[model samples]
Target: MTDNWSEVDLVLKTMVSTCLANEKYFGDLDSVVGDGDFGYSLARGFEKLQAQYDELDRTDIGTFLKKVGMLVTSRIGGTSGPIWGTGFLRAGMTAGATTELDGATVVKMLRSAVEGIQARGQAELGDKTLLDALVPMTDAIEEALAAGATSTEVVGRAAVAARSAADATAQLVAKRGRAAYTGERSRGSVDAGATAVAVIIEQIAEVWKTRESR
Candidate 1:
């Protein structure tokens, strides 16, 4: 499977579309434990991002990803903006001028993204934040890759683990963000941010699976 810049673009577009489609659902989930604007922020940000998609430099994935970070940071709201923006920016830096990413490269990029989020958010595992989903998913991908799994398998495994981790957030006590204000009340509700993380990873896995089949 040739996971080139064009394929990455398609994957990003898919992520935007998917986030738009589930906007209301995300809002509803956030309403349970947060300020309830997570969906609107994500939808609006991605909409603007889609408008500027063609402006990204296609020759370098690093430039494209950095552009993505800037756009999301400028347009998105709440904590999602900075967290996601930092992640993409760090990933872009790690990618440098590369136009294509093999499995190892993908692992490195994702690890950088995770590290960026950690540095920016100051959150860790069991924080009832996106980290709850991202960290586990990244670990799953790394383990799969270490076991000689195919790219498709690695992404698929990560997605599945991310979904489960997102779901597990409902069982965790709030420790960060607005959810922390709820204290015990935050329990039993899914985290919108974690769900968003799962959704994007799932979309990436889906894109890769389709690409590999072709």
Candidate 2:
């Protein structure tokens, strides 16, 4: 029953803030096997979003998200830009002109975002990429809603699933992105992008829980 663009805006705002706050942590995770710029790049992109947030078109959820996607894509550095940007863009496309979003629509939007990321990054579920966490997170959200969970419960379950999946990436060898270049050396460390997803979801869950109480 989660509806309205303001709620969506709040979620996005939380995501942006979470990314900014975890910039150093994410960069450290990436440095284990990547170029160590994952956090920096993501933060820089979200910074632009934060800066222009108030100015974004609120014509509809779709329009607002599309603008955010475009801004992130153009501003973020390295490969993170296109990958993260595509996720947002595809979600926006799926949302279309909708002003209110139900649970089912939210799941659909997440599925579309995951597909877009897969296509854009040429990645799969076990690729040790963000998909590892994102796919499970989306699935958890769908399952939670199907089971009649409330908004807070749905996001809380998603956060747990994402965290578990992201942690499991430590056992996987990178198959894509800069981390892949490290071969077996990447097996010991978690994927930065996947970890970021988990952290963001956890923050969103907390925020949603607080919102629900009020």
Candidate 3:
């Protein structure tokens, strides 16, 4: 179980670093079918979070996440801002001032985040959006926890599931975002948002494995 704010902080920091490092890679993926700004937009938002990391509220996990969500919403540009921001906001709301998080709580928070993304973007499974990866990732986490896996093991499973799901989006038709405008042309390329989710989860899992080794 991730039972402290410091661990949560570490995960968020890793996410920020991952986004910054992959800015160009993500942008290139987006250029395939999207407006080519998904990476730029996400990196810009996370840069703000990185810049003000020390100043963020740490009263609790929920408060911290809510602040991060608000920053992402206001600082990021384009459609990516609201959809991603809503996920953080809803996850924080579900956490509700908690200081400790068990596996079940984490899964619940993830579910809430996924729902928020769906509601904000009017997206669903098979939409070829980030949801394609995120939903499967969450399910893998839940399953890993149910099977009595360690936190690192659960994250590893999630990373695999997210990557597989993201890759599968290459076979799907874009049904959301600017990619949808491409019609059949979008079928061969993977969704940038989904790929980003997979990359992020993979980074998290890698970080967790290193931490466990230490």
* TM-score of every prediction relative to native: 0.94, 0.98, 0.98
Model 1 residue 88 CA deviation in Å: 0.6
Overall lDDT per candidate, in order of appearance: 0.87, 0.92, 0.93
Give the per-residue lDDT digits (tens) of candidate 1, residues 1-214.
2357666877689889988988998899999989999999999889998898888776688888998999999998988899988888988989888777876777788889988988899888888999899889989988998899887898899999999999999999988889899999999997899999899889889888897799
Q: Model 2: which ten-residue window has the lowest total lDDT?
A: 1-10
Backbone clash total for model 3 is 0
**Where is the poorest 10-residue window by lDDT in model 3?**
1-10
Q: How close is candidate 2 to the true structure, as a TM-score?
A: 0.98
Residue 98 lDDT (model 3): 81
Q: Give per-residue lDDT, candidate 2, residue 66.
A: 90
Model 2 clash tally, residue pairs: 0
Per-residue error for 195 in candidate 1, Å, reads 1.0
lDDT tens digits by residue: candidate 2, 1-214: 4577668877999999999999999999999999999999999999999999999998998888899899999999988999999999999999999799998988999999999999998999998999999999999999999999878889999999999999999999999998899899999899999999999999998888888898
What is the model-wide C-alpha lDDT for candidate 2? Answer: 0.92
